[model samples]
Target: MNTFKDDTLGSIFFQVMRLHHIRSHTLMGMQKIHRGQPPILGLLWDKDGRTQKEISEELHLQPATVTVMLQRMEKSGLIERRSDSEDLRISRVYLTDKGKQIKDNVEEAIKRLEDECFDGFTIEEKLLLRRFFIHMRDNLLKVSEYKEI
Candidate 1:
């Protein structure tokens, strides 16, 4: 019988997650979406005109980190930051026309990565795994931070 030695279930989970992250980065990088940008772009593409703070919060990224990525993206002509009319201090992120044009392609790249990762999994199995992972995440969260689904 063969077994993975010195690896607990949690360690295996961590390894899988790391691999998933690396795979996602490679897949998205091919489309010129750097390691830190896809999640930000994904959010904006899904619903444009979000505050920088909101993007940071939604993606669980630091505000400073988001700012740096936003700067890079702005330089790449992918997004523009505009001051809020009511609160000039708050900068809202809007995708450029170039960014909008690539949204579908970016989404497709991400979908390809996801589909590749889940290839061969039956729908029932995929659903069960999703439920398990969500439950595990909820278990790790504080009671007040988690809502039952």
Candidate 2:
């Protein structure tokens, strides 16, 4: 196995993040879901009917990107879009039976991934690590001068 020549924190952290992303991508692929679709699905699961604009804003995704994702999801029979009863201009997205049924499988896959990521870590250690991550995130946000993203 190859090892990093530069042992800096940033380099190590980048490698960890890359590997985590790759693992997550593969895990999601196994569930027949795309990389960015889980969160959208989760949102819809939480509230079955939401407008496209709501989803886009809530997820902080570009409207065009959300449109494309919704298009693909609609084509795949995972979600259906319908005109709002009160407003014809607005479209609401609702999960199909397939989409609703996949919730359990998607959740299970994520849980497995999380378990793997925290393998061999005690409960206390996990809690501490979570705190450290939150601190790191706050530090970055402060330096970037973005109070909210």
Candidate 3:
């Protein structure tokens, strides 16, 4: 079996997550969607007409980061931002028809990637892995404030 150069748990975890991120980016790229845009799109999917601030808070992203993503998405015709009628200063984001249409494609791409990732894992193993991940997240949460990517 091939061994990693650094066999420490932290190193191995980083390597695994890095590889996973690359694969996910590739899959999302195939759909012409950047990896960062999916989370925002997901929020808009669940509930349309959300403000930039709402998206930023919900996704744990900085306001500037969300703004950049929204700008790109608007240019791609995936979403549109309009001034809220009641509050002209607030801009509410809404998914365009193209954005609504790409939901299936995005989901399928994610499903395919997940299927490949868990190819050899059994149901019990998958459940155990999920629990481990949750525990790891909890551990991090107990420490200083952690920002998710």
Q: Estimate each model's TM-score.
A: 0.83, 0.91, 0.93
Q: Any runs in candidate 2 off by more than 4 Å, and if so which?
A: 1-3, 143-146
In model 1, the runs with Cα more than 4 Å from the true position are 1-7, 143-149
True-structure Cα RMSD, model 2: 2.1
lDDT, residue 84, model 1: 90
Ranking by lDDT: 3, 2, 1
**Candidate 1 lDDT, tens digit per residue, 95-116?**
9998888777778888898898
| Stronger candidate by lDDT (1 vs 2) | 2
Each prediction's whole-model lDDT (CA): 0.83, 0.91, 0.92
CA shift at 4, candidate 3, in angstroms?
3.8
- Runs in model 3 with CA error above 4 Å? 1-3, 146-149
Give the Å error, residue 21, model 1: 1.3
Candidate 2 lDDT tens digits, 1-149: 34366678888888888888999999999988887899899999999889999999888788999999999899988999999999999999999999999999999999998999999999999999999999998988898845655
Residue 12 deviation, candidate 1, in Å?
2.0
Please, what are the lDDT tens digits per residue for candidate 3 over residues 51-122? 999999898878999989999999999999999999999999999999999999999998999999899999
Highest lDDT scorer: 3
TM-score ranking of the models: 3, 2, 1
* Colliding pairs, model 2: none
